[model samples]
Target: MDTVPETRIGWTFLTNHARVLTAIADNPSVRIRDIAAHCRLTERAVQKIITDLEEDGYLSHIREGRANTYRIVPGKVLRHPAEAGLTVGSLLSLLVQDESERSPQYAHVKQ
Candidate 1:
């Protein structure tokens, strides 16, 4: 794995898939470009991740004119055996923060 030459925060605890899902959870109508930017990933990578999530029943999207509106499949169990009983809703609850709760002033404050 390539490490960041600066901070050296090479890998994160959350997977790319989890990151994408949380982005969608934060804003159902978010664009793929925005997600790519937020996750620091390529747009193609984000598209593939979205496809994987949709194919596995973890997520779904609706076509609305020029944009796609996503709808997470809540209550769907996570795939890994370690997270068997955990649902998508629970996982998102842990990652997706409310806008008001995500103020920059509290960025360093511990929960």
Candidate 2:
């Protein structure tokens, strides 16, 4: 039996933090397991990222029964000095994939 190696790309446009946040934005009640799967990270990694985001005041969640409903602070400015005045909303807008990108023939033209 042969095992396929992981596609370890050097880097991506968005950080894991950003990816996790976007997944939460898409579905507030999403499970950490799903976010991990979407971000290609482990469940433990996703949990840590959520803790970091919450500690930094970018994210907050409410426990509703057995699920958590996440709330993103849209007005929260980015951490980097270069991204001054850029809000969380701005970052998430760019990360969200469009309908065209889902097409089989759509080549992801690097921006």
Candidate 3:
């Protein structure tokens, strides 16, 4: 009997943090549940990531009734020495796609 090779998943180029941030950039008014679903992460994970971003001054939120409206702090610098001078806005521009330009897989994802 021939044994089939098991394909192992490797590290992704982007971290879960970047994924969550990109999701938020796509929709500032998006909900935490929505972000979790879109990023394939737990709500708790998303909440923690959001808190971390806020504490570092990379992100902020304004309470609007039952929902939170997030705002990415503009002109904030990236952390890594290799990515010196890179801004969150620039990173999002590379990762985020306009609603009309997104592929079919992301069509169901809210903007």
Candidate 4:
């Protein structure tokens, strides 16, 4: 009997920074361990990404007991030249679907 070997899939183009940002956007007060699990990265890597984002003014964190509460700066301009003058709000608008047309889980979360 022959058994199939497990294959590991690696990320292609998406950066760790992007993954961290998306994770934070989804849950403002998500734990670092949760972020690592969601992003398939190590805790140290997630911590580095969080530090980078904070230093770049993309995110601001408030220490709330043991958990850090994160706030995104939606007005910050994107760094790419092609995206010049575009703010985080504009980018999120493009990504977000119409709430009324979404599934119950998505709709419930918004409310």
Candidate 5:
């Protein structure tokens, strides 16, 4: 009998920064705890990443009562030379696709 892998490999195409950014883009009012949960990172780690992004001019946030509402700088250019001229808006558009919003039903589909 064959078994499925329960854990992911050590690496992926996107970095933790990208994942954190993606998570925030998914929900502007998302909590740090929620972002940590989604990104498989510790709350401290997420907080540090948020700081880095803010320092680099990629993101910002404002306190709304007890919660924080994030604001992404969509016009900021990406870091890599290869992605030169590409805006944060473009990256978020690709990562936050409509398909991701739909509940997946792949279990019912045959391989």
Candidate 6:
């Protein structure tokens, strides 16, 4: 019997903070389940990401009945000193490719 090596991809390369920011940028009203699915992460992971983003001033949420509306602060600078003064928009552009240019697996989910 041969054992296969575990390989990590995509979201694994991103910090939870970055993932949540990207998820919200992709869809402000997106649910936790949907974000987890899209990001190839777990619901708990998504929830934690959201919490971290909110705590760090990168995101804010407003309760709207059964759903929460998220607002991203695009002007917020990244944490790294080398990345200081760079906005969330700049960071997201580097992390996420446009929908039309993505592979088929992600094409349908592209905005």
Q: What global local distance difference test value does model 3 have? A: 0.82
What is the alpha-carbon lDDT of model 5 when measured against the actual structure?
0.81
Error of 1 at 56 (Å): 0.2
In angstroms, how far off is 44's CA in candidate 3? Answer: 0.4
Off by over 4 Å in 1: 1-9, 103-111
Clashing pairs in 5: none
Which candidate order results from sorting by lDDT in descending order? 1, 3, 5, 2, 6, 4
**Residue by residue across 3-62, what tens digits does model 3's lDDT show?**
213534897688889989987887787888877877678999999999999999999999
Candidate 5's displacement at residue 8, Å, is 1.7
Candidate 5 — worst ten consecutive residues by lDDT sum? 102-111
Cα lDDT of all candidates, in order?
Answer: 0.82, 0.80, 0.82, 0.71, 0.81, 0.73
Better of 3 and 4 by TM-score: 3
Candidate 3 ranges beyond 4 A from true positions: 1-8, 103-111
Query: Tens digit of lDDT per residue, candidate 4, span 26-58?
Result: 667888887786666899999999999899999
Better of 3 and 5 by lDDT: 3
| Residue 60 lDDT, candidate 1, scale 0-100 | 98
Candidate 4: which pairs clash? none
Q: Is candidate 2 or candidate 3 better by TM-score?
A: 3
Residues 6-110 of candidate 2: C-alpha lDDT, one tens digit per residue: 657697677899889987876777888877866789999999999999999999999988789999999999999999999999888886566555332112211
TM-scores of the candidates are: 0.83, 0.79, 0.82, 0.72, 0.81, 0.71
> What lDDT is obtained when candidate 4 is compared to the true structure?
0.71
- Candidate 1, poorest ten consecutive residues by summed lDDT: 102-111
* Model 6: per-residue Cα lDDT over 1-109, one tens digit each: 0122254754456676676677677667778876776666799988888888889988999988888889988788888898878998789888766866644432333
State, as a TM-score between 0 and 1, how close model 1 is to the true structure: 0.83
Q: Model 5 off-target regions past 4 Å?
A: 1-6, 99-111
For each candidate, how many residue pairs have backbone atoms clashing (under 3 Å)?
0, 0, 0, 0, 0, 0
